[model samples]
Every structure is written in C-alpha cells, then in structure tokens.
Target chain A: MLEGILTGLSTATMPVNLFMVFIGCFVGTFIGMLPGLGPISAIALMIPITYGLDPASGIILMAGVYYGAIFGGSTSSILINAPGCSGTVVTAFDGYPLAQKGQAGKALALAAYASFTGGTISAVFLLVAAPALASVSLSFQSADYFALMVLGLSAVAAFSGKGNILKALMMTVLGLMISTIGTDRSSGVDRFTFGRMDLVDGISFLLLAMATFALAEALMSVLKPEDNGEADEDAMRNLGSMKLNKEEIKEVAPVIARSSVLGFFVGVLPGAGATIAAFLAYGFERNLAKAKEKLKFGLGSLKGLAAPEAANNAASSGSFVPLLTLGIPGSGTTAIMLGALISYGIQPGPRLFLDNPEVFWSVIISMYVGNIVLLILNLPLIPYISRLLAVPRQVLVPMILLFSITGVYLVSFNSADILIMVIITVLAIVLRLLDFPLAPLLLGFILGGMLEDNLRRALLISDGGYSFIWERPITLTIFCITLFVLVAPLASGMWKKYRKKTVGYGASMQE
Target chain B: MTISRDQIAGLVFLVFSLAYGFYATDIALLPGEEFEPINARTMPYVLSGLGAALSFFFVLASWRSAGTLKPLKLGLMAWPPVIALLVVMVIYGLILNWLGFVVSTALFLIAGFRIMGERRPKILFGVSIPFVAISWFCLTQLLDIYLAPGRLFSLLGG
Candidate 1:
C-alpha cells in the first residue's frame, strides 16, 4: 500500500500530468464560478474533449475539475448568496451572511483553508480505505449489489428530507421506468421503443442530466429577475479589511475536523452526496455547540460556515470510493465521470486496481494536488471571482441558455436531443414551481438503470426467490441500515409530538 | 395549477405505461434456461407496477394538498429568452441537414447573439465565424465524428 501511494505520487509528478492538473483546476474554477454550473456539467462538456486523450490524463484532468469546482463553488455562494452548485448551498447559509457583514474575504480564506484540510485528509482516507473496500467488493455477488442499489435508492429517499418523501419515491420510480425504454438486453426484443430507431437504445443518462440540470437551471435563471442593487456598497468597502480573528479560528478548528470525518463517511454512502453531508455536518456542529448561549448559526457563524465547507469538500473526495471500487457512483458528478469513463472504454470496477493502478492512483494523487492549487487560487482570487456577481442577469442568463443548447446539441448531434432538452426543461420548471426536490429526481435517474440491471441479474441468479436479499449478511446489513435511516426520523418525530402533547395535557390538568 | 391537472397527467402516464408494459411482456422472448425463471419482462413489469402505484399516490397527494397551493410569480422578461431558444432550435433543426455544421453554427450563433440583445453586428460575425471554423476543424477534421457539411462547403472539398 505504501509503495502504491509512492507510485501514485510519482505518476502525478510527471510534467504532462502536472500541466493537466493546472488546466483542469483553471477550467474547473471558471466553471464552478458560473452560477448553476456544477462539476457535472463541466465534466460533461469536456468528455468529448477528453475522448482523444490518454485514460490516465483524462481521469486526472476530470478529477482536478471535480475537486477544484467544489472550492470555486464556495466563492459565489459566499459572495452573492447564490450557490454555484448544490453542494455549496449550505455554505451560503452562513457564508452569504458573512459576506453581508463585510467579511467576505475572511470567510473565503477560511473556506479555502478548511477545504484544503478536509480534502487532503479525506484523500488519505480514500487511499487507505479504497483498496480495503475494493478487496471486500471482490466478494460481492450480483445479489449483494442488487440489495446495495435498493439500499442506495432508499437512502436517497430518506435523506431527501421529510416534506418530499412521496415525490422523491415517485421520481425514483419514474427514473426506473425511463431506464427501461430501450430494447430488452437479454431478449433482444424492443420493449418501449414505440417503433422508433432512436428508441432502440435507451435515453442517454447524460442527455437526461443535461436536460434536468443545465437546461432547467438556465430556464429558471431567465425567469428570475437580475439583482440590481441588493448587496450593500458599504459592506463591499469593509470587505477589503475583513479577516478572521484568532478567537474565531480557535472556535472553528474542531468543528472543521469533526465535520470533515463525518462528511467523508456520509459521502462513502451511495446516493447521499456532498449536499446531505454538508447539511448533516452543520446539524451536528450546531447541536454540539454551546446551547446556553444563542449561537447565530445560519447567519455568519464561522462554525456553521466551516462545518459544511469542510464536509462538502471531504464528501467530494469520499464519493470517488464507490465509483473506483464497485463501479457505483455516489453522486451526480461521479455518475457523469462514470459515463465519461465508459465512453472511453474504461470500465471502473474492482479489476481497475490491478488493470490500471496508474489511472486510479494518479487521479487520486491529482485530487490532493488540485486541492492545494485551488487553495492558493481561491485565497487571493476571491475578490476577482466575486466580481462575477456584478454581471447583469439578463446578459448572463441568455449566454448560459445559448451555451446549454449548443453544448447539448454538439454532444449527440441529434435534433431529437434538442427537443428532449426542451421537454425536460419545461418539466423541470413545472416540478420546481411545485416545490419538488430536483436532487432526488437526478439521483433517481442515475441509480435507476444500475438498480434495474442488478435486481434482474440477482433474481435470475437466485431463481426468482426474493430471499437472496436476506440470505447474504452484507446485503442484510445494508438493508437494515437503510431501514433505520428511513424509519428513525419518522419515529423520532412522532415521539417528540407525543411527548409535547402529553406535557401540555399535564400542565392544563395541574392548572 | 389544479389538482385535476396533476391527476390527469398521472392517470394518462399510468395508462400509457401499463399498455406499454403489457406489450413489452408479450414481445419479450424468455430464455429456456433451467436456472433462472425471471426474464427481461420482470423488471419492466415491476417498474410498471411502481409507476402505477406512484401515479395513484400523486392523485391522492394532490387531492389532499390542493388547498396548500400558493400563487407563483412569473417574470415577464423571461419569455423572450424562451422564445429565442425555441426559435434557434427550430432554425438549427431546419438548417442542420442542408447548411450543415459550419454555416449552420455560425448563422445560429450570430442570430443568437442578436436575439440576446448584442447589437454590434461586426463583433457578432467576427466572434461567431472563427468559432464555427474551429468547431468544424476539431469535430470533423480531427476527431472523425461525421458532421453534415454544407453544400457550399462541399464545393471546397469538405
């Protein structure tokens, strides 16, 4: 393992690899600075560009984009209360408030530092944990994988929050249904093609993702008015001198450490991703902090800002574990990476370690280097990047819309894809207006095919018995944990309500 | 906007999916292998069932939550971009087969810039033409992805 780590570092030190790292970070920061453009879109846009490159170089560049985008996302969120990506939404909770308080520079600096610490530590964890996980994954049968996918889907629903449980389930079901739109893989007979040649193959996940995220977001941005004079000029002036005091650092350091560990673990779980990790980390930090004194969490609390910033960056690194080890993507960004890998004929699985150790380890090594590079870039470049918020929304939204359409069209070279983009974008707009969570919809689309494939294969192997999920200890353990995550919240919420009612009744009787 | 809209859409999708699922089951030819009884239709049928259940859930939920609907504000200025996109897509679709890659993209970008309120025609043409040329070279000349070459471009041995 030690030798492998050294080997990985040596490969990453090559000039070509180093140059790719810089290019990826530069492109990633630019993409990440753009509102509503996340690592997924950036990577998706670049997949065709990487198609001609070597596999290791391609993977390293993409990994650099992924981690660098996480760092860049914090800048927009802190500056303008606009989360450049879903993972950075929690950062905006406290980050924008800090910006409002004229401490944008300090918040940004701390964010970069915390991101660096979280990312480096998590990369080390990934190096240690991925090989062990890969070894264990070697034992996993089709049944175990099937159970695991179900657990992943259920966990997405559970973590999607309580208000949207039914909608999330519906979206997951819809995604699974969409996954079956092509010809039957085993039977070689058309299933839901409706006699169209294009339908012979299923709808592309990339197309669906672009439609849902990029197209939908662009449309939504157009519908929203441009911010003309929201931010205070006085606050902007004060930002020139903003810096974190020593006392603030002493308070935030432990929270960052704890959240980093917590976020990494949450990210290791399939379908949870960085957003949930950040939220959970923030919740943990808030609950653990001094309760007697009212801590201004959600309003420029340094701990609140640091916890999620650290957690999400760690989560970004943690998410790569399943993708590299088991060929499962833990988030939307990783799913796009998986798609890009497949397009390059590089199948990511347990055999990846033996077959392409350089590809695996070099990409991992680039992640560490990418994080350090981003820290340097973000700390000094915050003011410049923050200036992006001053651009008129009218000008920006149209350009984004134009690029989105062009990008989607360029990828498939199919007119039908453009039409699909419009349809999905409209659907997304309606869904968003209805208050449905878009992340669950995306999570569903991603895991739907894998879940269907694995479930069918498992049943075939088990000879149609449903008992396979319970027979395997690993599968059963995952199922139990999934059940716990789902049921725990409902049970606790009911219990709390019950206690409150009883206490009220007792008080009335005493009165 | 109404519970009926949600219910109707859900029911329509449910029926469509059910029909498709049944048709798919009939079309699918199961293997004669002794080891496994499950076939391709099993997963589709399962998904169909889930879809049907969710459609019903949507109907129920929309009914129960009907009163909770809030008024949504729409920005009027947003319509122009949507219309512009629609227009660009139509134009692209129409020209892609005839005008091909370079000409179509340049025209599209130029028109797109104008529609988005860029008034400097010189800048528009200058920026767009080179972009189209580069995209043409990269996609067709280098990567070997077949793009439709314009009739005019073909005269130049494209």
Candidate 2:
C-alpha cells in the first residue's frame, strides 16, 4: 500500500499531470460558478479536452474538476444564494445568510476549511476502503456483477427524491433501451441500427452526455428561464474580512468532523451522492444543535455551513470508492466519469486495481491535492470568480452551446451527430420538463451494456436456468439488497405517514 | 379527463416501447443463435417488456392523481427563441459540410447570440471570429487533428 501510494505520488506530481489538475480546477471553478451549469455538465465539457491526454492524467484532471465544481457551487451559494448544482444547494441555507450579515468572507473561508478537512479525511478513508473493496470485488463473478448492477440501478431509482422513483425507473429503462440502438457487442449483429452506419457504433457516450447535460441544460435555461433572481454586484465586491476567530473554529470543528464521517459513509452507498450527503449532514447538525443554535441554521449558523461544506466534499471523495472498486457509479457525475474511463479502453473495476494501480492511486492522491488547491488557490479568487457571474447571459450561453456541440463535433467531425444531439436534447428537455429524473437514464445507459453482458455470461454459466442468480450467495445477497432498496421507499413513505398521524408532526419533520 | 405531464410522458414511453419491441424481431439472428440461451433479440425483448410494464404502471400511478399531478406548462415557455435556436443548430449542422468549422461555427454563435438578443455586430463577430480561429488553429496545427476545408473551398480550389 505504501509503495502504491509512492507510485501514485510520483505520477500525480508529474509536471503535465499537475498542470492538468490546475487547468481542470480553474476551468471547473469557472463553469461551476455559473448558476445553471452543474458538475456533470462541467465534467462533460472537459471530457473532450481530456481525450488528448493519458488516462491517469485525464482522470486526475476530472477528479480535480469534480471537487472544483463542488467548491465553486458553494461559492455561488454563499455570494449570490444561487447554487451552481444540487450538491451545493444546502450550502446556500446558511452561507447566503452569512453573506447577508457582512460575513461573506468568513463564510467563504469556513467553507474552504470544511471542504479541505472533509476532502482530506475522506481521501484517507477512500485510500483504505477502495483497495479493500477492490480485493473483495476481485472475486466477483458474472452473476455477482449482474446483481451489483441491478442494485446500483435500483438504488438510484429509490433515492431519486420521493415521487421521482417510478419516473427515474422509467428513464432507466429508456436509457437501457437507447443503449441497444447499435450493434450487439457479443453477437456481432446489429440490433436497431435500421441500416444506418452511424448507428453501427450506437451512440457515443460523449454525444449523449453532452446532449443530455451540457446542451440540454443550456437550452433548458433559455426555454424555461428559471428565476433564481440575482445577486447584488456590490455585495460580492466586498466580502468582509475572510477570517475565523478561535472560538468560531472551535465551534464548527466538531461539526465538520462529524459531517465528514456521515458524508463519507452516505457517499459510499450505491446511489446516494454529495447532494444527499450535504442535505443529510445539514439536517444531522441541525438536530444536534440546541433550540437557539437550531434557529440559526437557516440564518447563518457557522455549524450549519461547516457541516454541509465538509459532508459534500467528503461525499465527493466517498463516491469514488464505488467507481474505483465496484465499477458502479454512486452518482450521476461519476457515471459520466465511468463512461470517459471506458472510452479510454480502461474499465474501472477490480481488474483496474491490478492492471492500472497508478491510475487508481494517482486519482486518490490527486484528490487530496485537489482539495488543497481548492482551498489555497480558489478561496482568494472567489471575489474575482464571482465577478464572472456578471458576464452577459447572451455571450456565455452561446459559448456554452458552442462548446457543447463542438465537443461532439470535434470527436466524430460528423454533421449527423450534431443533429442527433439536438434531437436528443429536445427529448431530454421535454423529459426534464416532465420531471423525469435524467440521471438514472444516464446511469442506466452507461451500465446497460455491462448489465446485459454480465446477464448473458451468468445465463451461459447457469446453462440458461437463471439459477446462477440464486445459486451464488454473493449474487443472491446483492439481489436481495436491490429488492430491499426497491421496497424501501414505499415502506419509508408509509412509516412517515403513520408517524405523522400518531406523533402529530413529530421530531422527524422538524429537521 | 385532462392529461397531466406524467400521463403524457408515460403514454409516449409506452408507444415507444411497443415500437421498439416490434422492431426487435427484425434484428437478424444467426441460424443457431436463437436456439442459444440469449441472442441479440433477447436483451431488447426484455428491455421492451420492462419499459412497457414500467410505463404502464407510470400511467396508472398518475391516473386521476390530480392533486399532485402537474398540468403541462408549455404555455409558460418562451417558445419562439428556443425553436429559433433549434433551427439555428440544425442549420449549423447542415452548413458545416459546405462551410466547414470556422464559417458554420461563427454563424451558429452569431445566430445564438442574436436569438438570445445580442444585436451588436462588433461583439458578435468579435467573439465568434477570434474564438473559431483559435479553436481551428489549435485543432489543426497544435493538436494535428486534420479538419478538411469546406466542400466549397475544395471545389473552388480544384
């Protein structure tokens, strides 16, 4: 493990890799500061640029971007009360109130510190957890893999907000269906190409990612024009002394520590991502607070701010565990990363541990560096980066659209791809409007080929009896978990209802 | 009954799945492949069935659930510029083969800016021209990715 860490340190410290990380963080911060764009879109936009680099550097760059984007999201949340992504939505609860109280600097500084601590601790945990899980998953058979995929999909659907589960599952099915468009990998026969050569390779992951995330998000902003309101340009200029007194630090220190642990564990769950982690951590901290301090939660409580900031960053690191070890993405952003990794011809499963230890370890090491970079480099630049928010929507929107389409165009240089992207974007926008969760579709699409492949192998091993699922204890355990995940939402909803009736707006509803 | 957004999406997915299932049969299987445990059609068949069932339940879940079901809010959107932007994107795709990267991308950017209400010619050409030039230079010169000159240029040169 020490040797592997040294190897990772060497690769991560390489001039080019370090430069890529810097560039990724810079670009990611910029993109993420925008009100509408999220980390998934930010990473998707960067995917084209990473194609020119080696896999290790590429992944390192992406990891930096993921952290940068989250940090950047927190900045906007603090300065303007407009979170760049869902993960940072909770950051705004206390952060914006701090900004309003002329403590914007303190809030920003606290966020950076909390993020740094969370990222560092979770990186340590990931270092231990990822390899341990990798060693165990190394023994995963085709049946086990198929069951894991099922669990990943089910968990995603189950956690996709209260009413969105069915919609999310439908979108997952839709994504899986879309994945069958081109030639079947195992059979060497076309499935739904309809005699089109473009369909021969099916849809490129880049195109779908760009369309659904970057392009669709850009267009949806234009289409719907969400009124997130605006930030006071003057308030941003003077962020009011970015310093934390000893007492302030002492107060939030324990909160940050606790949230980091909570966030890491939640992130390790198959479908729970940073957004849920931040929300959970914030809720947890609020519950722990006394009545007076609890009242300050939505009104610039340092503990409230620190808790989510730490948890979200820690959860970001924890989410990588499933991606690195199990090859199942815990979140939508990682799903895009998984796609990019596969495109690099490097599958990110247990085999990745042996075949590309450098890629695995370097990512873990670089995450720590990424967190440090976010703190040292980005904290000071928040004032200037926030100024970028003033850039005319007219210019920025077009530029983003151009990047989104050009990203796909540069890859295949095919004109038809742009058309397909637009069509998909249209469909995606409609679905978005309909409130069908797009992440599951993306996750399902990414896992679609693998799921089918594993199922086929499992069936083949079982001689078409479907017994491989139940015969293997590991596979059965995973399938049982999947089933439990599917039923959990209904059961929880019922419990909540019963509790509400009996307890009369119980403590559960308070947080 | 007035259909909600959920019902609409469900119905559309249901139809799409049926069509997909119908087309799955047309996928040519090898002589002995069908007799095998799974073929190219098997996954598609399963997906189609799942999609149909899921969409069916989705429809049923929304059926008469009026309190929670959001009515489609299509009228709230500013459709003209969005539709115009879509047209601009499609046109950009069409013209790219003829005009190549620089010209088509410039036009796309210009149109996008314009649709989004940017009328200043200076800003339009200023951003698009320099941006395209740098991007083109980077791709062709620095990166060594060959982007052929537009068909019109090729024809004229010949």
Candidate 3:
C-alpha cells in the first residue's frame, strides 16, 4: 500500500501533471466566477483540448478545473447575490447578505477558509472511502450493478421532490429514451439513428450535458434581465483585508466538520449532488439554531455559510467514488468524466484498480494536491475575484452567451448540436417561467441512461423474473432504502398538515 | 389559464416517445443464445410505459389541482428569442452543408446579436470578426478538428 501511494505521488508530481493542475484550477476558478457557467460547461469546453494530452494529464486537468470551479463559485455568491452555479446557491444565502452589510471582506475570507476545510476533509474521506468501495465492488456481479443503478434512479426520483414527480419522471424517461438514440450495444441494429450518420455512435453525453445545463442556463439568464444593482459602488471593497474573529472561527469550525461528513455521505448517494447536499446542510444547521438565531441564516450566519460550503465541496469529492469504483456516475460532472474515460478506452470498474493502479491512485493523489493548491491560490485572490462583481451584467451576459455558443459548437463541430442546444434552452426557459425546477431535469438527464442500461441488463440476466430484484440482498437493501426515501417525505408532509388541522379545530372550539 | 396545454403537451411527448421505443424494439436484434430474451429495447419500453403513465397522471393531477394551479405569464422578450432561435436553427440546418462553419456561424452570431438589440455596427463588426477568426483558428489550426469552411472558403485554400 505504501509503495502504491509513493508511486502515485511520484506520478502526480511530474511537471506535466503539476502544470495541468494549475491550468485546470485557474480556468475552473474563472469559469466558476462567471454567473451562468458551471463545471459542466467548463469541462465541455476543455474536453476538446484534452484530445491532445495523455489520459492521466487530461484527467488531472479536468479534476483541477472541477475543484477550482467549486471554490470559485463562492466568489460570486459572496460578492453578489447571484450564485455562479447551483452548488454555490447555499453560499448566497449568507454570503450576499454579508456583502450587503459591508462585511463582504469577512464573508469572503470565511468562505475561503470554510471551502478549504471542507475540501481537505472530504479529500481525506475520499482517500479512505474510494479504495474501500472499490474493494467491495470487486465482489459485485452484474446483478449487484443492476440493483445499484435501480437504486440510483429511485434515489433521483426521491430527491426530485413530490411536487414535480411527474415532470421528474418524464425527464428521467426522456433521458433514458435519448440514451437509446444510437446503435444498439448488444445488437448490430440501429435503434434511432434516423439515417443520420453522426448519431450512429449516440448523442454525446458531453453535448447533451452542455445543452441541458449550460445552454439552458445561458438562455434563462438572457431572457430575464439580471439586476445589476448588486454591482453598485459598495461591491468594490477588498475582502482580503478582513479577518474572522476567534469566536467566529470557533462557531464555524464545528459546522464545517459536521457538514464535511454530511456532505460526503450526500455525495456518495447517486443523484443527490452538491446543491441538495448544501441545501440539506443549511436546513439542518437552521433547525439546530434558536428561532431568533435562525434569522441570521440567510442574513449572514457564519454557520450558514460554512455548512453548505463544506457540504458542497465534500459532495463534489464524494461524487467520484461511484464513478471510479462502480462505473456509475453520481452526478452530471462525473457522468461526463465517465464518458471521457470511456472515450479514452479506459473502462472504469473494479478492474481499473487491478489493471491500472497508477491511474486510480494517481488521480486520488492529484485531487489532494489540487485541494491544497486551490486553498493557497484562493486565499490571497479573494479580493481580486470579488472585483468581478463590478462587471456589468449587460457586458457579462453577452460574453457568456457568446462563450456558450462557441463552446457548444466546438464540441462536435455539428450545427445539429447547436440546434439541439437552442431547443433545450427554449424548453428550459419555458419550464423555468412555469416555476418547474431545472435541477431535477438535469438529474433525470444524467441518470436516465444508467437507469435504462441497468434495468435491461438486470432483466436479461433474470430472464424476466421479478424475484431477482428482491432475491439479491444488496438490491433488496437499496430498493428498501429508495422506498423509505420516497415515502418518508410524503408521510411527514401529511402528518404536518394533519397536525395543523387538529390545532385549527381546537382553536375554533376554544373561540 | 388552460391546464390542458400542459397535459396535452405531456401526453403528446409521452405518446411519441412510446412509439419511438416500440419502433426501436422492433428493429433491435437480440444477442447470442447464451444471453436471456431481454435485450436493449426492453428497458426503453419500460421507461416509455412509465413516461406515458406519468403523463396521464400529470393530466389528472392538473385537473385536480386546477383551482390551485397558477396561470403562467411569460416575459415580453421571451417569444422573440424563442422564435428567432427556432427559425435560425431550421435555416442553419439546411445551409450548414452548403455554406459551412465559417459563413454559417458568422451569419448566425451576427443575426443573433442583432435580435438581442446590439445595433452598433462597430460592436457588431468588432464582436463578429474576432469571433470568426478565433473560432476558425482554434478549431481548425490548434485542435486539428475538421470544420466545414464552406465552398467559398474552400476555394480560398481553407
């Protein structure tokens, strides 16, 4: 094990790997600072460049971008109310309010520290959990994998919330349908190529991801004119000058630790990405606070800022475990990585460990190095990034839209992809206007292919026997967990409504 | 504030998807005798069925919640961009093979910018020229990805 660790470290320390790490972090931070761009878009844009590099270096660069982007996301949330990405939405709860109060400096400092803490702690967890999970996955048959995919899909449904259950289900189904657009994997027959030669290999996950998330977001931003008042004179203050008091540090440290653990677990769950983890962490933190104390949450509670910041970063790290071990992606970013790995002739499974220990362990070591580098880079640079808030929305929006168009077009050099992007963008705009959540749609799109592939594979193995779903202990356990997740929320909501009715009746009788 | 629009759209999408799945299943040839009967199309069919059922449920739910479902009000700027995107996409689809990436993309970007109300000729030329140049160089020269430089550009040694 020690020899393996040393080998990994030596490989990651090479100048090429180091340079890619910096480049990824630098590009990631800038992209994350852009209000509408996310890691998905950043990765999509960068994938074209990676075609020229070695697989390890390419992977390292992408990883750097991923971690850097997450950290950079907090800059916008802190300086302005706008979160650059969904994962940073929780940061905006406290971050923007602090900026408004002329303590943007303090909030920015605390956010950086909290991010570092969360990322480092989660990196440690990943180091421990990933190898352990990979070992356990060595024992998994096709049956176990099939069950895991079902669990992943069901978990997405549960996390999607009951209010838009149908839409979420529809999105999931649509995703599965879209995944079937290329040639049949098991058979040589064309499924839905529609005589288009470009689609014979299937709709690239990279393109679909860009369309669903990046282009859709850019369109949404364009349709709704953003309030530029956030960039008013007060936004220009330097955040580096501020320091967190010892008391503030003490208050947030526990929150960071608790959220780090919570975030790691949330990330480990398929379909529950950083946004949900952060939101869940904030809700938990709020409940722990007093009623009056809760007032500080969205208005710059240190814990509020720390919890989600920690959780989201941890979730980001945790997302890789399933992808690396089980060959299943827990989030869209990881899904794209999975696609990239496959494109590079590297199949991510149990054999990934036995066949390529250097690839697996080196990637892990690089993540740790990336986290440390991000901390060092972001701490001093907070003030500089905070200045990004001053860029006018008029200018910024146009630039972002241009980048989106260019980026999407660059991916496949296909005009058809641009059209698909535009259509999805319009759909997203319409959906947003109607108050439907976009995250679930994205979640569905990411998981749809996995769910379809696994369900059929499982059935093929079982020979249409329903008993296989229950007979496998792991499958049964996952199914039960999914059932619990689905039913628990509805039960709690109904109980609350029932309690309210009873209380109202008692009040009427008293009157 | 017709709730039916949502339901109808959902139903149409669901039905089309189901048809597509059935068609896919019909075309799919199974693997070797070593494998079971279930093939690639089975899961798609299952998902399509689930989608159709969910769409029906959505319609029912919309009807049940009619009293509570709020009317959707779109912004003023919404329709123009949507229509422009649709029209441009159709046109681009047709002209892409004929005109190639350079001519098509320039026209698309310029028109898109105009639609967004950037009327300054200097701004238009400024953004358009650099965008075309950089995109061409990066995609063609740096990355080595083959882009359709159009018949006109091909004649000029593109």
Query: A1-511, model 2: which lDDT tens digit per residue?
Result: 8998999999999999988888788888888888778999999999998899999999999999999899989988898888989999999999999988889999999999999999999999999999999999999999999999999988988886447688889888888999988989897899889999988999998999999999888888788775544344656888999999999999999999999999999999989989899999999999999988998989899999999999999999999999999999988999999999999999999999899999999999999888888888888988888888788888998899889888888889899999999999999888888778888989999999999999999999999888997898988899999999998887897899898787865665775
- Model 2 Cα lDDT, one tens digit per residue, B72-150: 6789988888889888989989999998888888889988999999999998899889998999999989988988789
For TM-score, candidate 1 versus 2, the one ahead is 2
CA lDDT, every prediction? 0.75, 0.90, 0.73
List runs of model 3 lying over 4 Å from the truth: A230-233, A237-240, A289-295, A386-413, A435-464, A501-511, B4-9, B21-36, B81-108, B155-158
lDDT of 1 by residue, A278-354 (tens): 99998888898787423689778888899999999999999999989988777778877877787677778787887
Report the TM-score measured on chain A for model 2. Answer: 0.96
Model 1 lDDT vs. the true structure?
Answer: 0.75
- Top candidate (TM-score): 2
Name the 10 consecutive residues with the lowest summed lDDT in model 3 chain A. Answer: A230-239
lDDT of 1 at A179: 72
How much of the real interface does each model capture, measured as fnat? 0.51, 0.81, 0.53
Q: Rank candidates, TM-score, best first.
A: 2, 1, 3
lDDT string for model 3 (A47-138, tens) is 75776787788888888888878877887778767678779988998888778777877887787777778777887887888888888989
Candidate 2 has a TM-score of: 0.97
